[model samples]
Target: MLRSLWEYRHFILASIRAELKGRFARSRLGGLWFLLNPLAQTLIFSIVLSQVLQARLPDTEVKAAYPIYLLSGLAAWTLFSEILNRSTTIFIEQASVIKKIAFPRLCLPVIVWGSALTGHVLLIAAILFVFLFFGHVPGWSVLALPLGITLISALAFGLGIILGVLNVFVRDIGQIVAIVLQLWFWLTPIVYPASIVPERFRWAVDLNPMAPLVRIYQDALLFGHWPQPLTLAVPALVAAGAVTFAFVLFRRASPELVDAL
Candidate 1:
């Protein structure tokens, strides 16, 4: 599958470019809208939650700390949810291509991930700019962001392909996914700090796979702290194992999935 994707690299790049153009084609501002949406969301959330949840966040010298904290977590969460959500129906979205195209079937999800990553890059730039306004520089720990993104991307992609394959057979899985993501978003500490959760119920936060990933982002961007090597090493191992399993599963089921479509 990796070799197949590499061989069709041009096709993948073309598809990603077309996907971006198509998404912004109708918007007056074009691709700027991608940056705008997240900026607007950060503003609105900062406005509402900043005051209400201000007490929960740690005492810090960083100006506009809440917004920085919120946006950092949001960055990781956005990439995650976008990939998982898109992956769930990517095959269905490309049903015609899957049925008629002779190229590798794996490219479909790669397209989804690439398209989403394009938007995410824009958002990350926007987030870093916002940090500047708050008198925060990109700390040395910011260097760790790529590794954090890699871990979560692998996790999301691994889970997404699994659900995507299952949803190809059971349509109801998509419906359940919507609800699950909604609840999952709240369960993770995107808008609020994990510190606010009662200690007794903190296990919910601890068990969530995305929690550590979000913390990695927040720790790097907001607190200027790099996690211990062991902290990231564990998830790195898990993500690698999970992604390999997902790709194997996806490859094995490709023929049947194409027929189902």
Candidate 2:
């Protein structure tokens, strides 16, 4: 699959460009919509919840700490959700192309990644600018951002592709996933800090795979702290396992999947 994707790299890149262009073609703002959507969500959350949670933040020095915290974690969540959501529907969305084109099916997800990453990169730059504006520049720990992104992307894409494949056989799976993602977002502690979770419910955070990854983002981007090596353990393991499993499932299902599409 890796080699297949590589062999058709040009097609994947072109698809990515075309997908992005088509997404914003009719809109005047075009690419700015990517930055605006997430930023707007951050603004609403900051307005409604910041004062309630800001004082509870571990470090009090940074100006607009809550928004910074919110956006930092949100950057990871947005990248993740974008890929996962798109992966769930990529095959179905490109059903016509899949029927006509003889190219690698794996290229579909790669195109999803490429187009989503384009928006994510823009969001990251906006986030960094927000960090600087508030006098809270990240230190060398910022280097970990890419690793953080890699793990989150792998986990989302891996799990999402399987769900995407299953979604073909059971169309209800897509609807279920959409509802689950909404619940999953609140469960992961994006708008608030994990520390604030009630004691008895704290186990939920420990069990939640995304909890650790989001903390890595907050610590690295908002606090300028290196992620503890221990923190990467669960997400890394889960991501690796998910990817391996997804590839196996996708390979087995591809033939039937085309017919389903």
Candidate 3:
């Protein structure tokens, strides 16, 4: 396993570069779109829901400036969702390379996830700049941002690989994934603070696996608080389990992928 990964390290790097170039090469704004996309969504949501529409939090913990809180959570959720959404078609879209080249098939999904993450990282920087401009300095807990994002990437990649392989044989899997992620976006606490969730329904939100990760971003960036060790522990374990399961399924499905395509 280690040898295969080591051998493909160069290919993975190249793939990441290729993905980035492919995204921005023809664009006038180029990589600036990465920051613009998320910022636009944040502004629209803030205006429609927070300002014009007058949305309110169910719990007292959330402050009047809910837009910042919501944006922080959405930033993480968007990354996770983008990875899974794009990864579904990765194997199909790259079938030519898979058939013509003799590289690690796993690199396809990895590159997709990496590119999606790159955009998210850019958005994070934008978020930080906005905070700093507003006189909000993230505390030491901001260090946890990378770890939180890593966990999100792990979960997204694992699911992506599983779905990417499945999508080769079942075209419907891609459409289903789109629907699922849309529903999942609402199920998560991206628009509201987790504290607003009633106690009984809170577990349902926590069980989402993405919830704890969103909270990690919110706490670190917005509230300048460290995520409790136990809070991260549970989600970390879940992400590990997800990766293990997805890898096993991906491997089992890989050999048949070419045949299906």
Candidate 4:
């Protein structure tokens, strides 16, 4: 699959471009929607939760600390959830093309990842500009964003492809994943800081794979600090394992995927 994807790399790139163009083809805002949606979500969350969570934030000179933290975390979460959500239905949505074309099947998830990462970059730039206005721009640690993004995208795509394959047969799998992602969002602490979690329930936070990944973004963008290397151990290992499993499952199920569609 890797070689096949590389061999058809141009197609993957073109498909990503086509997907991006098609998405905003008729919309007036076009690419601005990428920045607006996340910005709007960050604003809504900040207004509703900032008052309640303000006291919990670290003592910072920056007045917009909470909003910065929320935006950084949301940027990471949006990239992750976007890929996961779309991957679930990608095959089903493209059933017509799948039946008609003979391109690399792996291209679907790669295309989703590329398109999502493009939007994520825009959101990150907007978040950084907002941070700049508040005198809280991230330091050199901002360079580590690609590493964080790679892990998050890998994990999301891995899990997404597995669920997407199952979704073709079960149908309920898609709905279940939708509900699970909602629960997963709250569980990962995008709005609230992990410090606010009660001592007894801290174990649940620690158990979440995304907790560490999201923390990397928050630390770098909000606090302008390099992530503790040890913090990435779990999610990195899990992402590797998940990728291995996803490909194995996808490769084995390749033939059946079309028939199921």
Q: What is the per-residue lDDT of model 2 for residues 135-233, given as tens digits with 9 covering 90 to 100?
A: 778888889888888889999989889998998888998899889989889989888888789999898888888988988888888788888878789
Tell me the spans in candidate 1 whose CA falls farther than 4 Å from its real position: 52-56
lDDT of 3: 0.81
Give the whole-model CA lDDT for all candidates, comma-separated: 0.84, 0.86, 0.81, 0.87
Give me the candidate number with maximum TM-score: 4
TM-score, ranked from best to worst: 4, 2, 1, 3
TM-score of 3: 0.91
Evaluated at residue 140, the lDDT of candidate 2 is: 84
Model 1 Cα displacement at 72 (Å)?
Answer: 0.6
Least lDDT summed over 10 consecutive residues: which range in candidate 3?
Answer: 56-65
RMSD of each: 1.7, 1.5, 2.2, 1.4
Error of 2 at 153 (Å): 0.5
- Could you estimate the TM-score for every candidate? 0.93, 0.95, 0.91, 0.96
- Cα lDDT tens digits, model 3, 1-261, are 447767888888887888789888879999888777777887888889888878766533535356667768888988898888888898899888888887768777777877888778888888888776656767898899999899999888878877887888889999999898988888788886676679988878977888889989988877778888887788788778878988898778778887788
If the candidates were sorted by their lDDT against the true structure, best first, what order would they fall in?
4, 2, 1, 3
